[model samples]
Target: MMVDVLYLTAAVCFIFALGGLSRAESAQRGNLCGIFGMAIACVAAYLSVNSADFWFILIAIVMGGGIGVFIARAVSMTALPQMVAGFHSLVGLAAVLISFSACFAPELFRISTPSGIKVLSLLEMGLGSTIGSVTFIGSLIAFLKLQGIYKGHSIPLPLNAFFASSICCLLFYFTVTESEEAFLLLTMISLLFGATLIMPVGGADMPVVVSMLNSYSGWATSGIGFTIGNHLLIITGALVGSSGAILSYIMCRGMNRSLWSVIFAPEQAKANDAVASGGTRAFKSGAPEDAAFILKNANSVIVVPGYGMATSKAQYALKELGDMLKKDGISVKYAIHPVAGRMPGHMNVLLAEADVRYDDVFELEEINRDFSSCDVAYVVGANDVVNPAAKNDPSCSIYGMPILEAEKAKIILFLKRSMGTGYAGIDNELFYASNTMVLLGDAKKTTEDIIKAMRE
Candidate 1:
């Protein structure tokens, strides 16, 4: 009863944590709530375990915690997406391992009977391991791709066949045969399916891919939680799985991509891995000094950020430029695309790290129309979000995606390394527009140079 009480309390705390994390102002409070809830859940689990298992569990806790803390502090923000993917793989792998243990020692898990293992228990083991196997390998591929360790550019394999056949076999084999060999073979198939499914996805789709893998990990955890009779794990897993799914849906909508299309990695989506530029389109180039003069005279400026900003670590200098502009009585705001950077909220987090005020930032829907009235649309390391091709080209892969309308601004200051496409690998017609000024250089150095020029 005490364990049940603690579980209920932890569940409530987790709900509160989710509510808190949904808002920027209460995010810190939310984090504290989550940590507290996990602590309580850990205590409940500890109380339920055998005395003989105590030392082993304690040692595991210590080792895992030590590694997590080290990675958290050592990893850079630019690499956070890969870190997250890596963590998801760990969760999935843990579920698979737990299922294996349950299979071997059913009596220890309280599922053995005169009639053999419980049907419900067998189903749980099968599902948990199957989903967990896929999640584990899929997340690993995502991490490798994000970290630039794997070149996953070959043609995508037939995932539809793998997904359908594997699940059908797992269900039938686990329920009818109830044999260990069937389970092992089906689990191997799931792992292979996951690897093939995600390996060929282009970088532009990484955010959605990460979100979907998170959802998979959550569902896998929940399935294993039922096998182990852990209420807290069930509740937490549901929350994470559902939230991840919703976030994935929202991001796909933002990118004008169908969720089914992204998950399946359709032919059309994979076709855009190479550049779509029509052989050396003409565009205007400018220096940091020219950008400085424009900023000096502008009445309103909106900064649009992308993944390039994250790689170049330019958010700090961008924040300084914002402060300088505000000091000189010019209005400044940051425009964040929903799918900007490598993950959801990536740009927002970067801006917050740079100490940019929350009030000055707006999402795609919030300030898109304002670009028309704004004097300068300062695009830093952004390409596709401002591209007109999404609206103009029906044949393009990114067609119908919502852009920031940066082209409508009186003057567009494009900060990028060259006249290349963004992650979507499609050229931005905005770069070649009459109003756009492409300033080629590292974004951080260019922003600093603009600051120096303004002073002179």
Candidate 2:
């Protein structure tokens, strides 16, 4: 009976946490709530009398905990999305492996007569294993693509088709024959198929891919919950799965691309020629002295950051530059676009970590209004988020995605590692605009140079 209470409490906490995560102001609170709920749930589970082997449980906790801690400490912020995808894969793989084990360990399947718990357990295990195995492989490939270990170009259609057909055949064999070997084979094949399915997706769509993997992990967890008759796991997993799927779809729409197309389409050519040929209109390389002279005249400056900022670890330096400008009586604010990094709310988290003043950070809707009023817009290590393609080119993959209208600012300073396009694999029209000056170099080094110039 107390087990029921523990499960319910876990479910309630998860819901509250999710609600808090909806807004940036409340996100930290949400994260805390979720962690608290998980702790309570684990304690309750431990208290419940179980006929299962203690060794299995102990081993699982130790292994899982070790892996989790290693990932948290080692993974870089720029690689966070891929790390998340990898975590989801591991979760799904756990469910699959656990379920497969239960079927073999008949002693673990015992149930009290009136409860019919054994029947429920078997069902949960079987379904969880099947779905989890598939998700595990899919998420693994998604992780690789996001990390650039697998190139973001589409894989051959024949390979995809072959895997799809193999999975179907395996499923049919499993359905017709209830043999344990058949189940294992199907699980392995399904995992292979999942990996193949995600391999072709490009880096521009990594966020969506990560979201989709999150959904898969949730659904797999729900299956495990059903097997164990844990109502809390089932509800929480379903909620997470559904919300993540919707978010992934919404993100795809934001990019003006269909989910299917993102997963299947070939990578578009980079915007090198258009950007190289476009006649310069405004900002060109002036002397570092000349640029400082212009900055001296500007009354207000707004800094727009993107994924590149995170990769270069330039947020703090950007803050320093902002401070320098402010000392000269120039006003500064940091404008953050939603989806500005590889993960959701990435920029906000990075800036928060840098201890940037909360008041200085403005959302897309709030900051766009000020672009016209600002004298200069300094872009550091950001490309896609400020690209003009989102606003004007229907044919572009990111046409509908909201972007920082930095181009509207009177003067623009664009910093980058190179002339390459951003994740969307398209040229940034803002780079070609007359008002924009491309400062080509490593972000930290470039920003340091600018800071030195300002001081001189």
Candidate 3:
């Protein structure tokens, strides 16, 4: 009875945590609420378990917690996406392993009958194992891509759909037959399906892919929850699954991509790279001093950030620059593209860390038109999000994607490592625009130099 109350409390805390996490202002509180809720849930779970398992569970928790803390401290903001993917994979693997334990010891889960394991249990375990296996391998592949291990390249298997369907059918058949072989076969084939599903997807859709995999992991957990008769697990899993799915859809819309197109027709995304291999395009270059001069003289400035900013960890210096300009009677605003970085809200996280004022930041739609009337658009370590090709090149993959109209500003000061294309592997026409001046260097170094120039 006490356990029930604790579970209920944990569930309520989770609800509040999700609500808090939706907005940046309450994000820290949300994290705390989540941590508190999990602690309550863990204590209740420990109490419910047998004495024999107490030491084992405690040891496992300590080891896992130690590893998690170490990784959280070591990983940079730029690598957060891959790290998230890796963590999601662990959830999936946990689900699969739990399903195995239940299958081998059906009596422990109270699903075994006089003749054999309950048919319903078999079905639940089958579904759980299948989804879990897929989520595990799929997330690993996503992590690899986000880590630049594969450069977003996908392995093409023309018969992927047919093979995946066939495996599912076989899995269902084996589950109905109540064969012990189902678990192993399900894991093996689903892993293959996982690889095939993600391999065809281009790098452009990785954010959505990560969200979808998260959803898969959640559903896998829910299926196992049903098998184990854990109501709290079911509730938590449903929350994660539904929320992840919604987030995925939202991100797809942000990229102007249909969810179906991103999932079933990765060829469209791959097509973006075909014309990206052209020779070096002519573009004008500028030093930090040139950018500093334009920034000082500008009446209004819009800052656009991307993955490069995260790579250089330039958010602190960037905020300093914004503060300086704002104090000099210049209107300083931040423009964020939804798909600007490797994951959703990547730029916002960095900027927030640097203590940028919330009121000064605006989304692509909010600040895009303002660029036309602006004095200077300061693009820091961003490329595709502000690319004019999305608007001008109809034949390109990202043609329909909405972009920040930094190109429309009176002057464009673009800072990046080089003149190369972004992850989408397409040239940004904004680079060669008449008003644009590309500043080539480390983003943090360039921004610091610009700050020094401004102070002089």
How would the candidate models be sorted by lDDT, starting from the highest? 1, 3, 2
Q: What is the TM-score of each candidate against the true structure?
A: 0.96, 0.86, 0.94
Q: After superposition, how far is residue 307 of candidate 2 from its true place, in Å?
A: 1.9
lDDT of 2 by residue, 1-456 (tens): 988998899899999898997777998898899999998898787777564666787798899889889989988766778888888888888888777766676455342235333544545565677679878888887777777677744568778778677656665555444457766776777677676677766665677777887888889989877766678889998998998898788667556567777676644534433543355344365445555666778999988888888889988888888788888889999898766777666787788777788898998888898999999998988888888877898777676788888988999988888777676667677876777777877787778777788787
Best by lDDT: 1
- RMSD to native, candidate 2: 3.8
Q: Global lDDT of each model?
A: 0.87, 0.76, 0.85
Model 1: what TM-score?
Answer: 0.96
lDDT of 3 by residue, 1-456 (tens): 899899988988888888897777897898899899999999988877645677788899999999999999999877889999999899989988998998889988889989998888888888888888889989998998888786544545556777587777866786788777767877788888887788767766788998899888889979998988887788888989998898898788887888877877777644666767678878899888889999999999999998889889999999999999989999999999887787787888789889998888999778877998999988988887887888888888778888888888999999989777786778888888888899999999999999999888
Better of 1 and 2 by TM-score: 1
Compose the digit string of candidate 1's lDDT tens values, residues 206-269.
Answer: 8899999989998998999888777777888899899889989988999999887775654564
Provide the RMSD of all predictions against the true structure, rounded to 1 decimal: 1.6, 3.8, 2.0
| Strongest candidate by TM-score | 1
Worst 10 residues of 3 by lDDT: 150-159
* Decreasing TM-score order of the candidates: 1, 3, 2
